[model samples]
Target: MEIKAKQLDSVNASAHIKIPSQELKNEVQNLAKKASKTLKIDGFRPGHVPVAVILKRYEKQLQNDAEQNLLKNALNNALKELKKDSKELVGEPYFEKFDKKDEEIDIEFILSFKPDLKLDDYEKYIPQYSEPKATKKEMDEKRKELLKTHASLEPIKGKRALKEGDFAKFDFEGFIDGKSFEGGKANDYVLEIGSKQFIPGFEEGMIGLKIGEEKDLNLSFPKEYPAQHLAGKEVVFKVKLHEIEELKIPELNEELLKKILPNEKEPNAELLEEKIEEQIKNEKLLKLVDEELKAKFADALIENYNFDLPKGIVEQETDMQFRSAWQNFSEEEKKELSQNREKAKEKRDSFKEEAQKSVKLTFIIDGLAKLRKIDINDQELIQAIYFEAYRNGINPKEHFENYKRQGALPAVKMALIEQKLFNDIFFFSKTNKKGEK
Candidate 1:
């Protein structure tokens, strides 16, 4: 093992790591020896396979494992030689190159760590403002809306033509050029007139039709419709309006309270009002506090913590942003830009400033979290992911694994950490200042 490393700066380093052929071969053999004890293969008894057979049969996998093992070893040795603790490391060490030749393996790695930020007193950035309060009138309005959501659907008292916001019970049969299509007919389907649940033109076509009135709506399926065969094809739906309906809003009494808040020990108007007030207060607090004060404070902190960012990371961010913008360009635009090198450089250069700021803010946040001892553990992160998955109706394990595979788990964890850090800061400050005159 030979490692030649140089410090690029206080927080960045570069190294050339090497492992001779003999060591790699020895590692592969060791791996094969371990695999022989646990592997099961055809024509061989479990835990009794020969190491030679295992090496020959799983050569690619063994080679990969061996390389990974050596890389880890190289990292540990490099850390020791550099006099840098593993705890101070930041993002994954970037591999500049990994070359495997007949006699040896060569690797180039660029390592970085959290900079020693001399951040100023960030508390001064916290904006001073009167905390927002939920008014009684607002709570009363919200409560009325909540009770209306629990309202029952009832037949309309006065018969009238269908209109936007009205609900309709109708029967519809669809046809393509006089021939009926599969899944083209339904009976007694209840739909909100302007909900847009149906294809475009279908809901609008239902307007102005009275109960018992029948009308034929001619439409073309959108080009991107899910049904490939029907996409961009013309169809006509013969719809007959059967009933008109409206929401019969209920009184916020005991019966309605029980329906809305089942299992509540005290399902009364007072309890409902309290819950409503909490909801309104939270909404206002987010708008007034998080958006206004917290955002302003973050910008101020970024300006206050003036420090140099890692150049490699900043360039990487700029490149990523430029490539993303390129992907969104129209093909003609891409062609024009590709033909004009100077113009393309200008396009890419526009992203550099923002990219620098973004990279710098990330490091600033990282240092601030360390200084404040604000941290997010693996369990807390996974719980947040699980809650998001539940809300979006996805399997939590699958979502986690998907994020892990895409190498996006770090970004997600960072986002959670940022949210946690900001919330923790604003919360305590607000609590301490609660009794201020």
Candidate 2:
């Protein structure tokens, strides 16, 4: 047997393997000898079947099995010679070409692997971003929102039409072509006006409607509506007003303060204001760090590191992303894609670059974490799990158990490490700039 491996690209390789026919013949003969002892023939006792009869009856089968075993062993040997474990390979080796001649069996395979990444001065590539701060207006709005949550809803004093910010209970039946459709009828549904919870024009049409009054709203469904039958169709919504309730927000006074801070011996407005400000700042900072700054830093890192991505990983990631995006498409859009193969292929191809970037960034971050010795210890893991549970309103113990059962603890740990690494890098960059000044 002879093997030659060549690097096709940074992340891919091609291997040519040749096995001499003599070796295959020898393997087949050895296998036949081993099988003869266990042979069961109607005309002969065990271990007494003629070798010629066995060869004549199962020559092709024995040869094929021997060929398969030889190929597997050869591939394993080749991988060992390359100093790569099977786990390091992406996807299965793709057979590019194969030929069987009287003298030798020749085969070619294309193998994909994770790319080697090299980063120079990676710290300098970390993008600088200003920490977000909450404005007074935003704080005031948050305070008002808190007050509203504590507020009560009261029935309108007298006969009056519903207005924005009023809660209404109403019955609605929608018709297309004078026939009611599925999911188009509801009775006594309470909705907050101006909340935009209903379809476009449905909520706006309910405004100014008095109790016990009925109105037919002529509206057209959006072109991209999820329901295929109703998309872009004109419909009539026969709405009947039931009751109107107005919100009565409590003022930020002594009674409200005492109620909110029952544990405080003497709750004061100054302390409350300071607490609210701090909460707003923390919220703003979290959003900035999680959503904006982290993404920018990742993008900058990706831009700075140039490396070939494993083709198999990029393809799989692209398909996964495309499936997720496809779930959000309107029925008509999906049908169109189903009908046009080229259009669907184009759409899937469009996600390839973004998928490559995402996959490449994952490896880069993982390598950086290892190089920097960033790790999530058991205590940190517990704290992270509890923090996640608190954010998601779940029991920490149950969440940890679920993660463990799903074998997702490693993924969680990796995410925590990446986040900590980025935070540290950001802090170091900021402090270094300050020191330079």
Candidate 3:
């Protein structure tokens, strides 16, 4: 056997392989013998069939099988010779050409793989941003919101028109084209006036209605409404205001604090306020880290690194992105896309650059993980799966099995590794700054 590798580009290569005819002939003879043991002849016993008869009866089939096996072995050997693994391949290698001449069979294969990345120095390319802090005003607002969660609703004392922020209990029936539609009527429905839970003008029209008052709201559904039949159509809601309720927020005193935190040995107003402030600060910081810092860091990394992406990998990533984005669309939007395939194609095409970037980033991260010896063991993987299951309110065992069936466990592990890498970088920066101080 002889093997030669040629670099087609940064992310592609070609391998020319040749196998001696003598080796193939030997393999073909071995296969013929194996097949002969299963043969049933009228005049000969099984396993006693003559080699000449076997060759005469199944020569083409045996030779084809031998060729297939030889090609597979040769490709594996060629990859090993080039210091590559089949797992590193983006897709199956393309059989560009093959031929047989005299005593040797020659074959060429085109292979796609991840390109080598030259990452820029992280300390210089990644930006620095100040950690977010929660202000007193923000803390106060959060505290109020938290209090409202525990508040009780009480009926209003006097005859007054409803207003925004008031919870109204009402009965209503909606009609389009002077005919009632499905899901157009409800009895004793409780709705917040400003919640926007109902269609436009339905809640707003009830804002000035007094108890026991009935009003007809005439409104038009937005053209982009999910229900195609009702979209852009005018409808009338005959609503009767039955009762109005207002929230009575509790005072943030010792009794309320003790009720909120039953395990506290010595709960006080100061401690409660401190806890609220700390919670708000942590929430804000996390939001800043994910939405701002992470995005900026990723963009900087992309700008600093350069590599050609494997075409097959990029196409797969792009298709995945397109499907994900399409799944998130409203029914109306999906209908529009389905009706116009060109528009859908344009949408998919728009993701090409982003897909390339995403594929490149995965390669860069994998390379860094290798260099840094970042790894996730079985225990860590199980723990991560359990955590994910808990977050999604699913059974851990079921989630694990689902991931395994979809072949997504590796993707999960990669996500965990990337998260760990980012966390390490963040903490390292913080520690280095403190050391400088």
Model 2 over residues 1-437: C-alpha lDDT tens digits? 99887776777777799999999998888888878889898898899887778777899999998998898887787777676777879766777689999999999877778767766467665555555567889888988988898899899989988999999999999999999999999999999999988889999999889999999999999999878889999999999999999999988899899977788899988878877887886676566667776787788888878877776677777887999899999999899999999999999999998998988888888888877777789999999999989998899999999999987797688788888887666544453232211
| lDDT rank order | 1, 2, 3
Please identify model 2 stretches exceeding 4 Å from their true place.
5-15, 21-68, 83-102, 108-122, 253-296, 303-359, 369-437
TM-score of every model versus the real structure: 0.69, 0.64, 0.66
Clashing pairs in 2: none
- The per-model lDDT (C-alpha) reads 0.84, 0.84, 0.82
Model 3: CA > 4 A from native:
6-13, 18-71, 83-107, 110-126, 259-265, 303-356, 367-437
Give the number of the best model, judged by TM-score. 1
Question: In candidate 2, residue 59 scores what lDDT?
Answer: 100
Candidate 1 local Cα displacement, residue 362, angstroms: 3.2
Shift in Å, residue 347, candidate 3: 15
Which parts of model 1 have CA positions greater than 4 angstroms off?
16-73, 96-108, 116-120, 127-141, 179-184, 220-233, 252-278, 284-297, 307-323, 329-356, 366-400, 420-437
Model 3 is weakest, by summed lDDT over 10 consecutive residues, at 428-437
Give one digit per residue, the lDDT tens place, for model 1 in 1-437: 89998888877888898899899999999999999999999889999999999988999999999999999989888888889988988767888789998999989988776678765476666666666567878977897789778888888877678889888999999999899999989999999989899889999999999999999999998999888999999999999999999877787677888887888987988887778887786677667665676677667777777765665687678888999888789999899999999998898889999897888888877777877788889998899989999998899999999989988887898888888777677665554244322
Candidate 3: how many backbone clashes?
0
Residue-wise lDDT of candidate 3 within 220-334, one digit each (tens)?
9999987899999999999999999998998888788887777889988888788888788667656765777667877877788887777667777888899989878999989
Q: Which is the winner by lDDT between candidate 2 and candidate 3?
A: 2
lDDT score, candidate 1, position 184: 89
